[model samples]
Target chain A: MENASVPSVDNIRFDGSARTRWRLGFDRVIGWLLPLLFLVAILPILSLVYYVSARALPTLSWTVLTSTSPYRTDALGVPIIGTFEVMLLATLLAVLFGLFGGIATAEFLSDRVAGWVRMSANLLVGTPSIIIGYFGYFTFVLYFGWGLSYIAGVFTLSFFMTPYVFRTADLAFTSVPRHIREAALGSGAKPSQYILKVGTPIAFPQILTGVFLAMAIGVGETAPIVLTTQPGVLVPQTVYSPVTFLTQLIWENFAQSQSSGLQVLAFQAAFLIMVVVIALNIVVRLISSRYRKRLEGLYA
Target chain B: MRWLRWVAALPALAPAAILIGILVALVGATSFTNFGWGFFGFHWDPPTDQWGIMVFLIGSFLTAVPALVFSMLIGIGIAVASATYLPGYLTRILDPFVDLLAGIPSVVYGIWAFVIVAPVFGSVLEPWLVMHVAFIPGFGPPTRTDGLGVLISIFILTLMALPITTLLIRDALRSVPRDLWESGLALGATRWEVVRRVAIPYGRRGIFSAAFLGFGRAFGETVAVAMVLGAATNLPKNVYDTGNTVAAQMFELLDSAIGGTGSPQILAALAEMALVLLGISLVVNVLGRRLIASLYTEQVQGL
Candidate 1:
């Protein structure tokens, strides 16, 4: 097999004087192929961005942004509101829980407990988002009788979001110098006060990045919403009423080959979602990269 | 203040507890269902109440396995290029775009597949494929499922897996010591030769973990697969045939199972399906984590 492609090392001169056709071919193939493949790999994503934006140009308007369409299916207003409501609620819960949960794991929990928390978080994060939705369906929808309500979606999204926040916060809190905590304690600050006054402020930037990342993830998530939120034509009356999402509109409406109008709405929704999701991710990468560099500078 | 100290742990603890409870509930819900070898048989007709998970299992793997292979090839290429071949400025721009791909929801991918890809395939690509490679198994005649089939599902999944696998593998490649490559190149080896001989061998574990992670994502993905896969409950005859994955089938079947038919048996069966998905994902995720941890340990030890 090796002989078919190229010569063995022993066959070649030890000096760099000789270069065979096979060797040159192998070098050129790899030299060109990897970069070309990388370009091909990103084509779909680039095309998605291009396609949605171009298609959305006709349907996007001030009217579309402000109010629901007269057709029940083509409306963007309610789904957009539902999307923000669920994301904001979930983010708030996730941040609150994640901050303390992370603090506890990094600062207060015993090694065994910390290990357990880390393991669980890892497992939960690894679990498919759909399963998380199914889990929400089982607990909140079935057991609690919430049916497809905002609270259920919020809880489920928060459940999914918490692990990410926890991991980021844990990393952030752990990076706080041990001496700072000691100094705070020695200054007669209580543990809570020390954590709040010293550790949290130090970790806030990184934690905020995590929160934003989670928000992006939750905002775009469709599975949990599919299972837990009531898929309705109307905007949600309250947190308890069933809500529509932009993703749901895209999924349910885009496949409608019958109506060009619904398809256009779906395309516009997709474009909007792409914008928001990409924006959040860029924010995350920017903040996190700068935060990492700052930490490196501090350590250095 | 003391109460607050303990309360801070609740948010983290609650999710962990919920995850565990979900697992237990899945088992408990499905415990009453009979899962003999026959249950794994490929007879999934819900009307007669004879539901076996084999078809969906095959569908999921049939799409996911090939998609994983495709993604690995592209992902490895991207990873290699990003770490070694690409200019730093290009890599900087490309990295965020790849992340943006990952961040985009699957539902959008589904819409893209249905709206843009399906028509394109039907009008142009599928006809060409059929003419050129009709003998091949996956390149057969396209069925009448609005052009949504396993092939499209595989394509969408490949796109979904690419960014995840690329990012993981790029990190793995980046972590390889510069000295290893320098030493190999110092021995009069070409850049490709140095990368193949030094960086890849050192980062093999991370690469494997990346593949596993991609596999995990592909296998359990829902919305995109649901929209593109045609949601048929039968075994696919070829890649062009309509098929349904476990998650897709569950999503479609759950409502009917819950409200329309309102049968406990079907609900239990759906629960069993969820259990299987849960189990496979958990195992794959744990393995991926282990591989990552091992690679980290190796790097720390200066290996």
Candidate 2:
């Protein structure tokens, strides 16, 4: 070390030494920079909320929500029903498999096996939604000859969600306290019983967060549905039949050529989607808080 | 009991199987076409049996790289603020906003980007840039058209990629030991200086990982980029020129691929594109995950 003067700490005083001044300058720049960049990052979502609401609010009506047989951008009735039915089905499928898979990783699998499963799930989570959509087109729509039907779309969309559910559920399950696991295992409880009664309840809140996350993804995703299912008016009579979706409604209506009135319907559909997502977020918070409070209030 | 354990592990097989199945499907399709290395050439005309993916690759590069740089900057700001600096109220608002943004599907972003954002860039921003900053390379006058091009796609992708990037980076920066910040500050460093020297350095790998993950995200984004990237195969002349990404190309031509409305060649080509895309994202995400193995749900299993 050069002993002439310790440059960073040398002459440390109120006005800041040269190095300190430089650091302060950088600090000031960053102080301004971080907040400014944050605002820029958020600008889209802010504008999206404000602008879509402004356009969609006045145009929203019972007819838009309830009417089925109409021209382009007329109503969301069929899409609404289809979305609800399909999302419920998709969420069920996603959660069920995600739970089993999560349980395997958290409770049953060897370390190497669990590592592979976790890695695969993480990879799929980042795998492009479009690729998943593309896969859905090939595997479900063509290979299976499902041909743009309800079950195909449900399976496709559900695939997009399972990785998320798995990651979160695995996390929740693994975090259960050691004593609790021992207590459950020491008793005469079967493996399944121990996992179901003790492990799941302990981790349910965190797992619920993933459920809501998948729910939100289910509402927002369009690629899987569009590629794997047909965009038609009526709700599918059977899993084989074609069905419509709200995101499709929003997608088709946003064309520059659509009349302002028609465009309003697109905004309405978007706004409706925002409402559902926001509600899921809020509901998850509420439930998690209540669940935590109950746990702490009773046990802690 | 042994059978029960094996049965319990069965569900873990699904994700790995699906991933391999996708690879197999894409490989089978690529083999069917027999395009081999010829698939990576420049042109994409289907009529004369000229099938190449170079243009869409370039398109994805143009949009996704810039989007990565931009979102990284914004994501760092967000991560730092939420993780360390911002007061409670601001983060309170920010946390929910980001959560809502994550849930706002790509289709909505597609609509908003095309209808709302593209016009502003076209009618207002591009003209001003043309007047004032024409000398700058990326800010030149429009060649093919205005708005709904590489610039708008980049902007939309930045927004689309923000939530996860920010969240990952926030997790990284937040994981910086409180003791480190306190030690820095106790040594007479300001709060900002502590952030500069302590929190950031500690969180560097996580931030880089976030970039890789975010890059994969924006690179593979389809609906928004397709809706706004002008849907034309024109090699983008400038930031304002329309171009097509591989994902967008797949979206546009996928119908013909299956229905036999166009040609069997297109399906094989799209499958190849999907495989290439999968290869790229898997590498990116694996690198990302490997960089911060401890940053995941940090749980200690019961003995």
Candidate 3:
């Protein structure tokens, strides 16, 4: 194969001995510069991890993770609980709404309808999370008089997350083998049966990918909740009532100039949010990798 | 059968309708109350009801446009250099860095800017520019105090955008068949000359799509901008001066509004949101249409 490909390399010719050598040297330098720039670009990320970890790690104990802090400065229990609550509520809403929405768009919508949905999905995905928070604030807080309630926070988060699920589910559903759908219909299986029994199982892994991505995005989201959620030190006793999550607790504390208690708690909250984000990322990677391996096994 | 098909489509239509309804309501709240041109003037006051988004609009442009320009130049150059010139080992090392950059959150970028880039700009770039280039026209006195406000915002935004831009350009260049490069070489063209004439022109549309997407990302960026912007609502006097974008302004306005003082200001901020939504919608539609058209045209040409 090497001998056969000799003609291919011979087709191109470099004439100037000195000029070519200089060009080669220049190209080598440019090549090195590209990687160096990439390293510089990521320095910010490395430093953030380092800064947060250095400050929060000594105080981060199992008790801190498991229990809500009674003192303002020492514990992150309430914020952790609030974080899990918000994530759980948001994920449930996203999965339910996104699954049905995705199916309808993929399978049954007219071209115009699908086009419009696709456009909306892209708009939602593209629009900054801050804008969505503003929308929630206006709609839920001002007009509806819900104030800084969990319902508003969940709604804002779910609104932002829905697009991820919609896109993923739509792709997964579309990827279902055409022959299987046809065969199901040929065998007189009802449309609902085809979707629930045949369509869902095959697309389960991809749907999981969508759910994981939505969870990851939702858990890290702060700007939207800045307006919708109450920024208090103590977590609210109930989800229906106004509640402060870990990030909000941090924001509140950090903003206050003289409140050392709030400052320390805020730092702790920031660290927890980072940890949650990192954990979510790892889970997503594991799930996706496992799914890919399963796919390869089936194909092979 | 037709009726059943329409019934089957109702689930999709419902969510679409909800999304459209919310968008319409937001637009109406922001625009229709004052006949839809509320964001044009310069009257943003918290105490009074008067509001305008002139400064925020300018801030968005100032921060996003420069970052977009810088990232495009650097990212596309890097993509080409890596794909066409680099050794395999270097590419492998660089790939993970790009992926990691893309994966990191925008807020993290903001923190990084505050911690790292701000001091660097204040100490290094400010002094160096003052010594070398300050006397030039348009280059003003170098006052470097807590420089994370605008310049660092731009730096962070550029880093956020770089990964996607580089990846898109790299993919585009890779699709330029090896035969094209060989043919160019056959004509005694230098590697750079071949790339300039052949690869760039072939990948122009893809490059535009990548750049347009980056523009959209930067334009709508909030968390990163908000974190490092110092929340200064002033119009930036220079690149180094602090400012806020439409998104950041919305965040600030909403935070204050939720504290329960200014209802009309909140309305005014909503007006800013409407403007941002309109601007984003227009950009996305235009870019999306162009991208689809080019893709189809490419398909037809290939066929």
> Which candidate number would show the highest lDDT if scored against the true structure?
2
Predicted candidate 3 versus true structure: per-residue lDDT over B1-303, tens digit per residue? 678867776656545664675676577666455523545656666556556677788888888888888888877877776666555566665655565566555654554465556788888886676677767643466455667567778888888777767766666676677788778767766566667899889877778866876777788777778877777767876666678888877766666766766666467556556556556745764584356323222111100
lDDT of 2 by residue, B78-156 (tens): 7776665555667766666665566688888887877788788888887888889889887787643347788889888
Cα-based TM-score, every candidate? 0.90, 0.92, 0.87
Question: Deviation in angstroms for A191 in model 3?
Answer: 3.0
Tens digits of lDDT, candidate 3, A1-300: 001110122234456598876765554465456556665555656777787677667666887666655554566777777778888888888887888888878888767767777667665666667767777777776677787888789888888888778777777787677888899878999877888999999888878877877776787677878778884456666665766666566555544552655554555566666766667556766666687688668654
**RMSD of each candidate?**
5.0, 5.0, 4.7
User: For all candidates, what are the clash counts?
Assistant: 0, 0, 1
B-chain TM-score, candidate 1: 0.91
Which segments of candidate 2 are over 4 A away from where they belong? A1-29, A70-73, A254-262, A289-300, B143-146, B256-260, B298-303
The residue-by-residue lDDT of candidate 2 on A1-300, one tens digit each, is: 010111132233657478878866765566556666666756777898888788888878898798877364478888899899889899999998887888888888888888888888878888888888878888888788888898988998888888878888888877777778888899888878888899988888888888897888778887777788877767688899888878866665653356876687778888889888878878877776687687678677
| C-alpha positional error of residue B153 in candidate 1 after TM-score superposition, expressed in Å | 1.2
Worst 10 residues of 3 chain B by lDDT: B294-303
Worst 10 residues of 3 chain A by lDDT: A1-10
Clashing residue pairs found in predicted model 3 = A68-A77
The local lDDT score (0 to 100) that residue A101 gets in candidate 1 is: 82
Clashes of 1: 0
